[model samples]
Target: MSPESLRGWVKRDRIDRGEGGPGELTSAEREELTRLRRQNAEQRKTIEILKKAAAFFARDSDR
Candidate 1:
């Protein structure tokens, strides 16, 4: 592997093993963060859709 890529992998491994430094995220934390971010985005999209549907129905009722 390239030296830079190897270095990055080693760094991540160290972080995952809790040997890198303080305040560094472990693999589990990173995965959870990714999952939460995806879920948040999905929830935001659903909220937007619901809001638009509510507005459309309200407008239709006035017609």
Candidate 2:
């Protein structure tokens, strides 16, 4: 699965556990997780845009 999907799963698991994952995260670890989540979101958005662009080019080339 995609990193984004894994991130979503982890987030849900953390929520269900009342905080953190299998092992509780320290403040520093939590900050890092937050940063990583933000980066993951940006990467997912970029991938989506790239996919659309690729599709558009492919369709155009078929003309």
Candidate 3:
């Protein structure tokens, strides 16, 4: 089975066992996740900007 499938099964099994049923993340954990997500978004935006700059530079070089 794919890793995604395995992760889904594990999540399902936890819910079935009633062990906090996937458990709500702690405030700290939630904040950490949010911070990480924001960082990831920022990184992606930076990468897109860099890619555009590179493409522009490459076109200029070809001229």
Candidate 4:
């Protein structure tokens, strides 16, 4: 691996082990945050689709 990449991994490992500093996220926290962000994006898309469907039905019923 490149030196920079290896250095980053070592830094992250230190942070995960609580040896680096305070307020740094552990690996599990990072994974959970990524998962939550993906889920939030999916929910937003679903809400948009539902809103469009509702508007379509509303206009159709008025005809």
Which candidate's lDDT is highest? 1
Q: Which pairs of residues collide in candidate 1? A: none
The most accurate candidate by TM-score is 4
* Candidate 2 local lDDT, 1-63, one digit each (tens): 999999988876766567865676655667899999999999999999999999999999999
Any idea how many clashes model 3 has?
A: 0
Q: Give the deviation of candidate 4 from the true structure as CA RMSD.
A: 2.1
> Roughly what TM-score does model 4 have, to 2 decimal places?
0.76
Q: Report, for every candidate in turn, its global Cα lDDT versus the true structure.
A: 0.95, 0.85, 0.80, 0.94
TM-score of each: 0.73, 0.63, 0.64, 0.76
How would you order the candidates by TM-score, starting with the best?
A: 4, 1, 3, 2
Residue lDDT tens for model 3, 1-63:
899999977765655556443565544566899999999999999999999999999999998
The candidate 1 region of ten consecutive residues with least summed lDDT is 15-24
Winner on lDDT between 1 and 3 is 1
- Winner by TM-score between candidate 4 and candidate 1: 4
Looking at candidate 3, the ten consecutive residues that score lowest on lDDT are: 19-28
Better of 1 and 3 by TM-score: 1
